[model samples]
Target: MLKKGLYGIYKGVEFRITVDMDNNLKIMTDKKEKTDSTFEDTYQSGVYTKIVKPNELVDCVSVTPFGIIKGEKVQILQEKENKYQVATGALLVGSNLNLPRIDRDSWLGWVSKGEVKLFEEITPINPEDL
Candidate 1:
């Protein structure tokens, strides 16, 4: 089954992110531990989830909103019909860049093996800064 959360690393720190149907991203540390709190002393409760620093960001394409696909810097323009449109200044990585069944093994492999340096860092500008 596909995992609900994405495990990734931004800079050097590890993080897990969940994107809801509305595209709201919730980033937290990838680790979790049982807490002292419990429900009726039977069910575990209150697991700790850490949030990313406001200024820090991850580079993994699977988790990042911006990326270099087919050599062009692109941002996710739309998501429909189980496909995504990633565009870069009128150019696009084409529809194939985003697929309903992503090749998670290859993508995650690149992330884990530190092979992402071959692609340029193309994080999009946050409008809030302007």
Candidate 2:
């Protein structure tokens, strides 16, 4: 079980679970702030705060550079070294953990609409490495 600020993968995406000074649990996703309505709405739609185990709400997964489309999993190779291709929900690393970037693109669109069972283990990653 993790305490306070930590990052975990939820449904193939990364999320930061934070405990405020007041002890209120806050689940944060990439690009969405606590104050964002989309964030609040997504948070409200799930249950994780009551669980004692971090895995109960999230998991750790490898950085999947490829994803499936239609029926085949395609690799998301960058057209150039260190180039950004705008992947929605692509697990990104930087100043903070980032979720895959979702947009109107067909590939990204497929990822955003996909679902994983609550607490389902996708890819287990160490918190420190996150």
Candidate 3:
């Protein structure tokens, strides 16, 4: 299985893999929960959200590296209370190259839930289609 923060093919579908750090390599996917569910009740595995607030600058938990602005995409790695652990970077799935070093340009840190909105619902690609 692909390690956390790495992008790879799983069951013929491309996914930016993440795992529950507290769990034993439990792979996280881009599946979202039903509408009625609350944040705590929702499965936050590989959920991806995009910055929606215009001109907004999201601050990292620790030292501020750079600004995360509108329309930037981030994957939800984990959720705690009102904040989410998100990763922002480019997708390397269909590049046709060996998996490069994890997240050369990625940013991983906590962001408030209000900074982002649900981008899309990811569905695994059909194996036969490949």
Candidate 1 local lDDT, 1-130, one digit each (tens): 1122255454575555444355544454323432122212223442334334435554533434544545544444434444444443341233344423234332111111121112233343331131
lDDT of each: 0.37, 0.39, 0.39
Model 2 misplacement above 4 A: 1-5, 30-38, 41-56, 60-130
TM-score, prediction 1: 0.25
Q: Give the per-residue lDDT digits (tens) of candidate 3, residues 1-130.
A: 1123333343343334333444322222444531113213234544542212211211211111222325564556666787666665655421221223356665566667676464433343222221
- The estimated TM-scores of all candidates read 0.25, 0.25, 0.32
Kindly list the per-residue Cα lDDT of model 2 for residues 2-67, writing each as its tens digit. 112355655555566665576654556445322333344436654333212444455644443443
lDDT of 2: 0.39
After superposition, candidate 1 runs with Cα above 4 Å error: 1-5, 19-25, 29-47, 63-130
